[model samples]
Target: MVLEVVGVSPEEESVYRLLVTSGRATAEDLAQRAGLPAADAARILDSLALKGLASHTDGTPRLFRAAPPDVALLPRLKRSADTLELARLEATRLIQAYQDTMRRHDAGQLLEVITGAEALRQHLRQIQTCAQDEMLWFCKAQYVAMPSGSNAEEFEALARGVRYRVLYEKAFFDDEGAVDNVVAGVRAGEVARAVPHLPLRLAIADRSVAVFPLVAGGPHGSPEEPTTALVRDSNLLAALIALFERYWEDAVPLRVDGSDALSGTDGSGPAEALSPTDRKLLSLLVAGVADKAIASQMGLSRRTVQRRIQAMMERAGAETRMQLAWHAAGHAWL
Candidate 1:
């Protein structure tokens, strides 16, 4: 019965397994062993031979050989697997299309509640994979459902030409490996930015649907299970979009070159001469990251970070850190 999925009937599978165990068999031998009539066994054997699962020799009563299961069944299994995957993808598209229609016609269908961490993660992945045009994200620290690097969906979506605009709070970089993840994302065509902070975690796909927490501080911060809301096209969705755009407008762009060095220039005044390290430091500073946090994120000591800031200030003829930041902005150094 296990082989039925690949088009083998239970009776045929039984005959095939018996044949495999016996190595080779005549129609009468298989019939006696399987408790089936000789005529029925002969018919099944012919069917199996036609399916490449068995072969017959040109002799007296004829002999049937069971093809090696590995050779005969593996290819069929692979083809079946491929077909199932295609069906799954088609089902996902059909479900999305149906949901889109319902959301458009029925106002009550606009909001769906996703409860628990695993469910939240699955919805996030589904939306990202289904997204056609763009994805907007507000990534905050102390992640509620999934870790930052666990988002393989983002890369897959990016590969298919889905534009990603992600805004990370400054504290997000304080997490271990967070900087490396951001760098990897940037290299893979993600457009990343850093903000001093964000109010909540959010994701919007194609500007038609949004997902965010129904109440903040769930399993991560409390004993309660996490709860999230999937909102499709409404004034609430528009407000969420506006919230992301507001922070995005002021957030510092995160850029890294092929060499893994942060790189940027405004092409105006002294900003054009700024080094990669300087550009990175200025971006973090402008986002209100603390000196120690900056040092940690950039893999530098606190003293070393201060020294670099001092050098940058002197280069820009700045008497203080504020003046250096002011100059960096004026010349579009970040």
Candidate 2:
């Protein structure tokens, strides 16, 4: 029974065990001990010998001896385990390929409508957890199924080296803790950008599948439940990916980490090196976020925000905010 997994049937094992107990046995002897027919015993013994579980001496009416179980069965079990592992890997590859092919041919498999907030949240989590290479996200204002700063999955994915490119609409920063969340993600290696507005909220994983809202406007508590679509490999998914890239090209990068923010600073650094705090402030400023909003997001008073801007202006030798923006760009400080 223990050797069955290594291709030893119960009958073969019984014949082999009998041979081992006898030290040496002919087919007739093993058949009598195993209570099997002589012909069946001979066949089983041959099967065990072929599997290296038994061997025969060179003589008439050959005496079959069970190979040392530790030496023979261990290797067979190891080989069986190795073969099973390879088969499992191949099966996974084939299943993925088959699903992709099906999605391409069947319209019904291309798009799945997910209704209700709970369902949408589950799909988002699943996609991020399954993402292998990269994840692209369009974050907009107003909470839907998942609110800003609550997607713990992104942090987990990032930790495992899944590159995340997230574009946030300007209004997204207005949400409480949004900027803090973005800073956390950037520090963890997420590439974040900002735009004045986004067409929709979307998330794509590995460029193979996408999820987007089916209804406009986020959760407003007006009894209008949110709906979303899970899109597989298709033309629509391609178009969505293209749209994200188009917007990404024009978006402004957010620099939260001091080292990374200054990594690209061009020739002749600022009069004084920009601290991490200053770099963060500068990033939001370049993104066209107002001082008041920046103050709120950065947990600073508006006066302090203006004071810091003035200080940066003096350091850049810029007379006005516009010139400071230009200086930041020329220096690659953003």
Candidate 3:
């Protein structure tokens, strides 16, 4: 570490150390002992004397002795501490002045990479707190959202009438009790949907801030350490929002039961909540949409949609697709 208080050059320190150890010594002797030239040694001793770290007497030649550290270094250290305090006071203005300059230039920071799962969770809570309008998410294949503060954060946001649209991958529904959990969320005022595939896990709030994982988790694969990014309002964030809307437009109803009273969701869940795309999916299932084409249009994969359909078929306790449809129609779930 640098000793800013003394602030002496290496050569000066060498000269001082030599004198302090040697008691009293001539410049010529110190120069030899300290590996410095005679003139350099003399100059350093005089400099140390000026700092009050050393004292000198003239006899046959000048002899120098170090002052006790308490008498010398202590005062210099105190002055340094005082100077640092003054700098600390001025730092507030300096920082704000810089921020003002950046604002005037219309230049500022917008993106940040966040590391560590706990820290990311903290940021999630912060994001919820900061949100003012809507929240969007693309949670795929696994539990990407490590619940922050015991599920209180999302509930608080929902309680405030903030819009929530969450998309899930087919894999997200495979977990035990997943349907029950989703029904709970639907009851809590979140419009939810599922697609064949999701490219990444993401959370965007108020159209102002967005986060996407750098590490994969859930069905994708659990990482010991997870990381994500927080991108502020920018072209990248806009593109992400657009991507979600496209998927939302084609997404099928994530419904187990058709009763609006049971869930309180305004019939926006995929299935009977039909757009032209859902109708096409319904029609094409009879002929087939060439999995790739359907997946592309729906922002998921053919396999993902296939898996979801199969899961629904099994939930209906049916052995075939026709049976699944008949069973669903009986409950008006289609």
Per-residue CA lDDT of model 1 for 261-325, tens digit only, reads 65321111255455577689889987889999999999989997887788677667899888988
Question: Which candidate leads the pack in TM-score?
Answer: 2
Q: What is the lDDT of residue 313 in candidate 1?
A: 76
- The global Cα lDDT (0 to 1) of model 3 is 0.71
Worst 10 residues of 1 by lDDT: 263-272
Scored by lDDT, the top model is 1
Encode model 2's per-residue lDDT on 5-72: one tens digit a residue.
88788877777777778888899988888788989888988888888888998898998888898998
lDDT preference between candidates 1 and 3, better one: 1
Residue pairs with colliding backbones in model 1 are: none
Q: What TM-score would each prediction reach against the true structure?
A: 0.50, 0.62, 0.48
Q: Put the candidates in TM-score order, highest first.
A: 2, 1, 3
Steric collisions counted per model: 0, 0, 5
Where does the lowest 10-residue lDDT sum fall in candidate 2?
A: 262-271
Question: Which portions of model 1 show Cα errors greater than 4 Å?
Answer: 1-107, 219-222, 262-334
What is the Cα-based lDDT of residue 167 in candidate 1?
85
**Model 3 error, position 284 (Å):** 13
lDDT of each: 0.85, 0.83, 0.71
